[model samples]
Target chain A: AQSVAQPEDQVNVAEGNPLTVKCTYSVSGNPYLFWYVQYPNRGLQFLLKYITGDNLVKGSYGFEAEFNKSQTSFHLKKPSALVSDSALYFCAVNYGGSYIPTFGRGTSLIVHP
Target chain B: DTAVSQTPKYLVTQMGNDKSIKCEQNLGHDTMYWYKQDSKKFLKIMFSYNNKELIINETVPNRFSPKSPDKAHLNLHINSLELGDSAVYFCASSQAQTRNEQFFGPGTRLTVL
Candidate 1:
């Protein structure tokens, strides 16, 4: 079975400051990791994904994630944060060869002005 | 146009009643999925369909059923709804059964009283 873990329940960052939301995964085979954001009463929006390529994967809204195989982590990062970036973020992973994807409890991101 | 869209963005019903949620995607994707987001914000996959064919079914209760009328539409019908079923149900679509990014709809807030 595949699983995802988000250690942080919430992450606080100031506007224009760097921000990160942590994520880790456990899968039997290789992993296809993804990051999504959800605003209140909204659906999950895709941010980025890691299939097989550079360890650093860039995504929408100037967001990116570093895929660390050894750490089993895919941490979402943004060089400069914006108040509009405040939302709930979730980390997801599906087995390399399966259609089942598991998501973690979302981490609330608070971007202060 | 919205890549994925769901109808009845909000639903409120009493327990033991039956309700349904409709979903559609215009991204020309072959796979559609239904995900549930609990009150605590833990999202999990409930079912998946590929080109109108059932492909992945999670350990969901029998009361919760999914129907894919075609490649572009997937509907969820919950019978004898319970309070535990009160959550946001999301519909999503992807290009393939695996190794593809999922586009999600705005989600339907189902409040089973």
Candidate 2:
């Protein structure tokens, strides 16, 4: 079984400051990791995914995440946070042979201006 | 054009009631999935269908059933709903062969009273 964990329940950052949201996963084989963002009352929107190669992956809306194999971690990061970036963020994982992905309890991000 | 769409953005029903949420995707993806986000913001995968065939069914109770009559549409039906069933249901789709970044619909918020 594949599972994901977001250690932080909430992350608060100020606009123009760097922000980070932590995530980790466990899977049988190679892991497919993903990050998604959800605004109020909306569905999840894909941010970025780590399939293979390149530990650092860039995604929509100036978001990026680094996949660390040794630590089994994939952390979302942004160089500068914006008030618009405040939302609920989720981490998900899918193993090599599994078609279904597992998601983490989302972390609420608050970017105050 | 909307990539993925779900109908009945909000649904409120009493216990034991039956209801269905309709989903459609114009992205021409082959894999579609259903997910539930509880009040605590924990998201879990419930079902996945590829090419109108059931591919992934999680430990969800039999009261929840998913139907995919065509590639572009997937619908979820819930029977004898319980208070625990109150959550946000999301429909998402991804191309199985290529980039697997799943696109999600707005989601249906089901409130079981």
**Winning model by lDDT:** 2
Which ranges of candidate 2 are over 4 A from the true structure? B52-58, B97-99
Question: Model 2's DockQ?
Answer: 0.62
In the range A6-83, model 1's lDDT, one tens digit per residue, is 999999999999999999999998889999999888888899999898999999999999999999999999999999
User: Which pairs clash (backbone N, Cα, C closer than 3 Å) in model 1?
Assistant: none
Best by DockQ: 1
TM-score for candidate 2 (chain B): 0.93
Docking class of 1: medium
**Clashing residue pairs in candidate 2 (N, C-alpha, C atoms within 3 angstroms):** none
**What fnat does each of the candidate structures reach?**
0.72, 0.60
Scanning candidate 1 chain B in windows of ten residues, the lowest lDDT window is B50-59
Per-residue lDDT tens digits for candidate 2, residues B1-113, read 88999999999999999999999999889999899888888887898889645765647999999898889999999999999999999999998733277899999999999
lDDT of 1: 0.90
In candidate 1, what are the lDDT values of residues B18-56, reduced to their tens digit?
999999999999888999988898887899888546755
Q: Please compute DockQ, using alpha carbons, for every candidate against the native two-chain complex.
A: 0.74, 0.62
